[model samples]
Target: MKAARIHAYGDADQIRVEDAPIPAIGPDDVLIRTVAASVNPVDWKIRRGYLEKMLPYDMPLTLGWDVSGIVEAIGADVTTFKPGDAVYSRPDIRRNGTYAEYVAVRAREVALKPTTISHVEAASLPLVSITAWEALITTAGLQPGQRVLIHAGAGGVGSIAIQLAKAKGAHVTATASQGKTALVRSLGADEVVDYHNPTAFAAARDMDIVFDTIGGDTQDASWAMLKPGGFLVSITAPPSAERALAEGKRVGFVFIDPNAAILRDLAQLVDGGKIRPLIGGEFRLDDAAKAQLASETGRTTGKIVIYTGQP
Candidate 1:
């Protein structure tokens, strides 16, 4: 098999496509024939050694996290899936990832791919969807009939977060470029603030939750948009301890985990037409470097997919 792997953490130039051995599965795992994967900012972060201390990976690592494919084989203890089943998963970040032509993922981390979408589309959802789920649903305890603000609404996590919040009956407010106002609104955001305008969200106070995907200034600005006692959840970095203490708010930083139950629920929402995956671009497996570059730029509208083309 050919995999895009890095011998040492550095830049995009470090990623090289080369021959590699097929992975052996444990009794609780399933071996998937790769069809497609998606690029995320964390992929590049890990590649450049930013997460080395936290993730503690061995050298010569494959760096993708999202996958949509067909099950080629299942291990002895795996009964939830079978040979020839279509599945998708945000595989455990500790293992060899989904960048190659094959990935062995724990059966509990895999779910049947939504039947309504293509492999490329299914590949786009896992990581981002899981991030949103952990942030709003698991961490913040967002409820219906409330208000939620999503930063970078056209982004991977934000786009899906807007729709999921709306599906739960929350009034969704999102920030995006002027050009993406319609796009975000179409995705169920009740209001779309112009991200380029510093004061565009000044009137967005009294929210039940704020989901921040953009850090730095954007995150700083989001602090003023929540009412007292509202929750603030971020996937980019940890919330400001000082600000949370002064503002009487609950702040949390979400490190996403793989849960088959969340993926199954998302699949139902997708197949029922209540939500959908947003695919911004596609690249071949050999072009993993290029895809990672695009994600690093922080300008992609949604998920950028990598097609492995393996049967």
Candidate 2:
């Protein structure tokens, strides 16, 4: 199978298309005939060896994290899906990824793709959706009728975070460019704060939770928005626990685990028309370098995906 892989960790030029052996399935895994995969920030981060210490894949790594495809075969213990089932997953980050024409994913992390959307759109949702899900729901323990502020509202995790927060009955305040207000509003953001403006902090106040996708000063200011005992969750980096405690807020840093239960919940939300993925752009499997460029440049609105099949 043809795959876009990185033999060395460096610039985008490091990714190359090569013919590699198809992925072999384990007893607990399924082999998916790839239709589409999405590029998350981690794809490029891992490609450049930024995450070498935390997640060390062997050299020549296939650098995609999300897949929406058809099951060509299933392992003996895989009873959740059958041959020819359409599925999607945020494959475990610890192994070879979904940049190939096919991927072998653990059955526990694969779920039935939502029938309401196309493969490209389905591909866009898994990683970011799971990340947002873990941040807003699992980590923060958000309750209905509360307020949650999400930084980087136009981003992959922020876009999904807005919708999931709204779905869970939280009033969401999201930070973005003034031009992106409509996009953020369309995603169910109750309040769209323009972070590009000089008065961004003055506009965002009194929140039950702060979901910061951008770390740094933006993350630090999120602490001020929270009332006493509110939650602060940052997916971009680990939270400063001492600072959080000083501000009288609970803080958490989330790392996504690709569980079928998480994907299944996201799938059901998609099926119910509560959450929709925002697809910024797409490239073919051979165009992974372009995808990496889009991610690093930070110009994309939401997810940038790689389609392995015809449009």
Candidate 3:
């Protein structure tokens, strides 16, 4: 099988597509013939060795976790899916990843691909959608009729978060560049703030939740926007516990724990037309490095998908 791997972390240039042995599965895992995968910021971050302390991945790592593929074989204990089943997952990031012709993923992490979308679109959903679902629904416990603000509303996680929040009947506000406001609004954001305009979000106060995908100054600014006791969940970095205490707000950092149950629910939402993927670009598996570069630009309106050139 051909896989895109980095023997040593550095830049996108370090990625090479080359022949590698197909991974064997464990008793609780399934072997998937990769159809498509998507590039997230974490892909490039891992390539740059930014997550070494936390992940400690072995060298020659295949650098993709978001996958939509067909099951080629299943482990003896895996009963939920069978050979030839179409599946999607944000597979555990500790293993060799999906940027290859074949990948082995834990059966507990896999879900049937949403029937309403294509493989490329399904490939785009798992990671970002799971992150959003975990942040808003699981951690924040967002309620209907509440107001919430999502940063980077046109980016991968933010785009899905907006739709999910709206599906939960929340009043959604989002931040995007001036150029992408319309796209953000189309994703069900009730109000779109131009992020380039520093004062644009001043009026966005008394929110029940603030989903922060961008850290640093953006996270700093979001604190004042939330009402007292409201939640602020960040995927980028952990917010200050002391500050949250001082301000009488709740704060948490979300590191996605892949859940097949959430993926199942997200698929139902996708099929029910309550959510849809926003794809910014597509690349062949051989161009995995190029896909990472595009994600590194941090300007894509949605997810960047990579096709493995398989059926």
Highest lDDT, which number? 3
Report the CA-based lDDT of candidate 2 relative to the real structure: 0.88
When 2 and 3 are scored with lDDT, the better candidate is: 3
Report, for all candidates in order, the number of backbone clashes: 0, 0, 0
Q: For candidate 1, lDDT tens digit of each residue in 1-311? A: 88899999998999998888989999999999989999998999999999888899987898899999999999999989999999999999999999899999999999999999998899999999988989999999989899999999999999899989988889999999999999999899999989777677677788889998888877887788888998889988899888899989989999888888999999999999998999898899889999999999988998999998563
**lDDT of candidate 1?**
0.91
Worst 10 residues of 2 by lDDT: 194-203
**How many Å off is the CA of 203 in candidate 2?**
2.5
Give the C-alpha miss distance for residue 194 in model 1, angstroms.
0.6
Q: Could you tell me every candidate's TM-score relative to the true structure?
A: 0.97, 0.97, 0.98
RMSD (Cα, Å) for all candidates, in order, is: 1.2, 1.2, 0.8
Q: Candidate 2's residue-wise lDDT over 1-311, tens digit each?
A: 98999898999999998998899899999999989999888888898899989986788788898999999999999888899899999988998899889899999989999999999999999888888888888889999999999888899888998999999999989988899999999999988888878687676888899998889888877777888999989888888888777778799988888877888888889999999989998888888899889999876799998887543
Highest TM-score: which candidate?
Answer: 3
Task: Give every collision pair in model 2.
Answer: none
Please identify model 2 stretches exceeding 4 Å from their true place: none
lDDT of 3 by residue, 226-253 (tens): 9999999999999999999999999989
